[model samples]
Target: DQIILLKDGRIAETGHFEDLMAAGQTFCQLISEYAVTHRGQDGSGSSSGADSDNAETQSQDMVGSGTGGDTAAAGTTPTSRDTRAKDAKKDAKKDKKAGIIQAENILDGGLSASIFLRYLRAITYKYATLIMLFQVLMQVCYVGTSLWLKYWIGQNEDTSPESRPSLSLFLSVFSGLTLVYVLMGIVLFWVAFGVARIRASEYLHRIFMSRIMRLPPAFFDTTPLGRIINRVSSDFASIDDRIPWKLFEAIGHAVSLVASLTVVAFTTPLFLVASPFIALIYYYVQKHYQRASQAVKRICRATQSPIFQHFQETLAGVSTIRAMNLQGRFIATSAERSDLYSNSFIALAYGIRWMEILVQMVNVVITLLASLWFVLLPQGSVNAATAGLALSFAMSNSQSLIWFARTYSDLYVHMIAVERVQEYAELRTEAPLSTAPDSETGRALEHHWPQEGRI
Candidate 1:
């Protein structure tokens, strides 16, 4: 058995384990002290001890490598825990030197282009055509309900009671549309989110776990187990549990936005003249907002990796922490990690606030302009139906525009997690036959096969 000793974080002694133990050196002294202190037997040699002694012994057995658990193979020496830790760090550094995360991946294109579409392809490819047509039909029905309600209100204002539809007919029509809306939600929840999200998460988990298992040992050296778990577990949980609903809501809002704009332009054709200016402002504001928000969110996500890493480290070394009474230091480190993530989140919230203020101000101007145009103009110039429809959109125009921007931003942020999971999904693997050929293995075979086969 060999023993290597470290002092000032540098190796200070190297020799056979039996020689070190006989020398009564630091290595032997540490082992004896640690075992006795952990075992909690009265160092005073008194036999009378309280129940606390028994409790401490039980705790030590759970945590410590006692005599029963300390057996190393005959040819092996139990290296100091500190040496094992240092060796692990060295291996991780070696792996990092082999393959590093690039600046381009972090700063520019880490989030793949059209990430949401990627998820859609993963989850909905088989039924994509059917889903697309169904979504359009659903949106049309939704818009039609609004249109019908507007027309009915206009009819009540302008037409005689005798010319109007009976109360029962109006109630029946409204009730049917209401039922249709409920059914749309049910279908969206059960089929769109439930089936799709669960299946996608399951498939992603399978491939992700498979790749992880097949990865080279060096990969695990550099990457903490917690980080890997964070990616496929918490990160994917967001994609599975949250992204589907967010995507569904985003699609609904987008359809509503288009439908509202189109309805306003069609019924009051002059409204299209103002549409471009409002759209230009909305586009500029949203673009700036997302740029800032996504950057902060990226930082937030990066810092979060360390938080998970620290949590696992603390958990595994809890006994050491308690023995050294460094709980305060560990807790402070945890808080610091939390604050790092929270600071970025606060920055994101501030940017959102600024965007909301600008969006609301623009909305007020648009609202006033629309109100004055309808009010100052001759009464019969714009029909009651058109006026009602146009004004309704104008009243909530700010909210819809802001809602779209927020939802778009949220979708992008969520896709960062998807991109990360995808990165892991594409990580280099070990047992590969049908998958892409391993470059190193392929090159070696190509170089040596000719020489071996020439015989």
Candidate 2:
């Protein structure tokens, strides 16, 4: 065995421990200082542990079940050996499952459209044909409502009595439209939310976790468990719980937008001429807002990782922190991290709110135009009913537009989570497990080269 010691990048000593001690005064003094520190720590730790043992005993006993059971057997149980065995096995199974990696988590490259499509396919590919057919039926019914309204209003116009709809006809038409709408809503909710969203979230989690398990140890070495946990738990929570609904509903609203635009174009022919300009404005606004919001959301997500990481580190080392009397320092650090995360979130929120204000102003303009044409021009048959119907569609579509934008943002952020998971999953793996000694230097490396100290 041999030892090589360095100071300031230059060799200070290279010898066995006894030889070093005989030759180096500084090394002996450093060793003595460490010994004193260790003794102090051991003495304080024993005394503090004595006070905590009784209070912490139950927790320790629970964790130690089916092991020696030295603490547990004293008070928790004596003959409940089978129960302990079952519990021990269950815990082991859980821990093992948590760490095990499946072969299914492989990913390709970056978050390209193909990757995004792959993700969507995992959620929706099975339902493609059915979903399309169902949505068509729903949109037809949704659009049909406006047509039905036009007919229903015709009853109020003065006409031949026989030509007018009878009481039964009116009731039947109203009931039919209501029934159709209710059915559309129910079916969309069940299929879009109940089936697709829930299953997609679960599959995403499986993929994310499987990938995490397969990641190299070096990935975890640099990343904090808290940050890792935040990505899987809270970020996944947002995607699983809300973002899917946002996406599904956004799609549903797109159908509504088409239907609304169709009605508006038919009732107010003038709007048809202006529709292209309106659409161009919408496209531009949506593109600009999406870019800005997505970028802000990414910033927020990045900032959130560190908050969780710092909090986890602090909690894990609280005892050591207290021993070192660094409570104020750690608390300040946690607060600083929290503040940084909050600034990003606050900025994101303000940006979305600003966009909302802009969208609402546009909606007001739409409503005003619809109303002003009906009031001022008094074009033939541009009655209150016609004006009101057009205005109502305008309002509905505006709300749908707002929600669609918000949902798009949600979708973007959630996809970022999947992308982050892929980041870990796609890390270049260490070469396949070695079966033979690596090289000539392996033998020397295996020996205890540092005879006196760690480098």
Candidate 3:
């Protein structure tokens, strides 16, 4: 019906296709070029005139289909432009569905034994054994020093001076044990835990990096650079610093708790009757608190990744955002992410406070029971030294118990970083960097056979 052609941003020709063809100008030349380029597709070996007619009919059909208009009046098809628009829409939908930054994955249930084993393997069995041994030695010296104090008090109270140990000897032995205990603690923290943490961090980081480097490009397309950065920066920092300290403190507190309980039981035999019930209460409290604590910690950590992702994106697109005048929108979005993280952190703090109150109540109950037992006991049934030691340990148990639960929960929560690191470390990497040669010829090729410019 009508034909229009533009050249250099101005209309060059306008008429019916037949009239334009008859004119034998720009429109006709364009039709002839198209037909010649697609000659193989037509497969008829027709003259350019016939092919041009076929092309005109195809254009009419395409334009009519696209616009839902009369075929004769629709004009040119614009096939390439239409195809590109359709493709762009499809890509947009796909990208919206499969987001560039994936949500952080969280594992449910309690920390697995496998994760512990993985960490132990990373640190090596030798270092782990040494760490355990040093911890035990440190605890022994601590408990022994306390017991020696009880013994010294007993000797001072004795009416028979001949049986009493020399004061100089007692002081020297006590001082020597104190020195040994301090030395053991120093070594345990700086040497055993330090070296083990460093080694584990290095091993996990290396494998994680190796796997990431070998991963296919498609992985990066879907995974945000910020998510990767979060793993390497925040997660590894926790592993390097927070985790080691949490683990060491957890173990130390646990050992100290056991020692306190043992001393309490020894000095106060009747208290043993209620120890089981007290332990059961502590177990349930820790169990429920730990579950909520870990969940909140996961939420806290997950929200952190989004913040980091957003921050990185904002930094990268700062100029673009400024140009678009979208700084306020980005800042609002960042504030929202930070608020989410802050809310999770607040929940975690509430959980800790709840645990503290409950644990303190339990400790008070324990101390009250111990005091009642001592006051009610028959005269001379319990000696002053043993009773004083029991009271001191019972009082100290409050702090020890709370620290034990806190450190234990923290240790497991921090282990999440290890789990994540190990997940990447064990990921299915891309095919080997250098595969076996294809055949004899490939095997025989020289290492530097591909000389410069040979291809």
Candidate 4:
């Protein structure tokens, strides 16, 4: 068994692919034998000991031995060992039938933390700094717009209208800046998608498949088909998904958020007070929403498995159902299951809606408070001219802050997808048992490369 520790210094998982394979093979034989021997206790063979220790042990050991990590862990992983094992087998069989390496499997066997980080660094290093520059400029424009917007709105309020022109000017600049951001966003997506499809995922997939194909025979024998399939499918997806979204979104959002805040602080020091308070509220709300969402997601996933199982069962036994005229029953049952799934989602959405309502309430409260302060205040009552400018700036900045806060929750929600993809990308693969023969390697190289430039 190979036991690896997670970043948290806890044992991650333990298993040898070889052991899983042997267990699987043994399980199949045992199942067949049990089926043949099964009968009533009426002077005939029967499955008397089917659930006995000996038989039970064989079945349990088949799935449990390689899944020792899951058994030992304090909390259960999302997927069960048996489910994982089954999926792996299905994937392997699919691959064999297709006569091509599984893309999912290959994806799972990608780089580890150290290697993956290094790759990420190399990929982002060149563009990251440039992106930051653009981000700073965008932030400046945002602040400029915020100040002008406040002035514009304030000018329309009681007292003389002095800040109107400044507000209009700021609005024009802000709109232009926003258009630029949109254009940049489009360009970035184009480049990232092209690179990932052509170079990143494809290249990694190739290397991963090559390594997987060369893994020691024992590795295959001990590992569950589902776990392996998960690594290939889920893990690969993690990496692929991360490259375009998590990585990019994190970078883009962080820059924008910081820049927008910087403008707010510079324009109105008093406004800075709202930032931390709003952030804290957002954090508190996010923690609650995240927990609820996670629970909802787990339920959703659980419901999906049984639904899928029933789907397959129905398809496989369609003839029997038709003959028995039980198609309506199956349809009704499916509809019920689907309703359950929908309800689970609705519950989740309701939770999100409540959170959103709370967020909006906070924003409204903040806006009202700021407006009240600007309206009253006897002496320094923000001199009609500056008051308009100050209010416009404050509103814009506050709105921007609210926007940033909202994005954090949205980001948290989206991170589930990122983690799923990462899980697959971090899967481990065993090394090849045999190295290339030096003589054969040389001959193959000579035949292919033709180093002398011969035809």
Per-candidate local distance difference test: 0.69, 0.64, 0.79, 0.53
Of models 2 and 4, which has the larger TM-score? 2
Residue pairs clashing, model 1: none
Question: 1-455, model 3: which lDDT tens digit per residue?
Answer: 67779999999999876566555567755554353345424344555455445655554453344332233222334453233334555665788898665666877888889999988888899888888888888889988988899889888887588887789999998999999999988888776566898998888888888899998888888788888898899889998888878877888898888888888888777668988888899999999999999898888878888898899889999999999999999999999999999999999999999998999988887788788889999998877888888999999999999999999998888898888887777777786745456753334455786787765
Off by over 4 Å in 2: 1-111, 161-163, 376-379, 429-455
Consecutive 10-residue window with the lowest summed lDDT within model 1: 68-77
191-216 in candidate 4: lDDT tens per residue?
Answer: 55555324556655666677667666
Give the best candidate by lDDT. 3
CA RMSD for every model?
A: 14.0, 18.2, 10.3, 15.9
Q: Over 4 Å off in model 3, which ranges? A: 1-101, 161-163, 437-455
Best candidate, TM-score: 3
By summed lDDT, which 10 consecutive residues of candidate 4 come out lowest? 35-44
- Model 4 has an lDDT value of 0.53
Compared with the true structure, the alpha-carbon lDDT of candidate 3 equals 0.79
| Model 3 poorest 10 in a row by lDDT | 66-75
- Candidate 4 or 3, higher lDDT: 3
Candidate no. 1 TM-score = 0.69
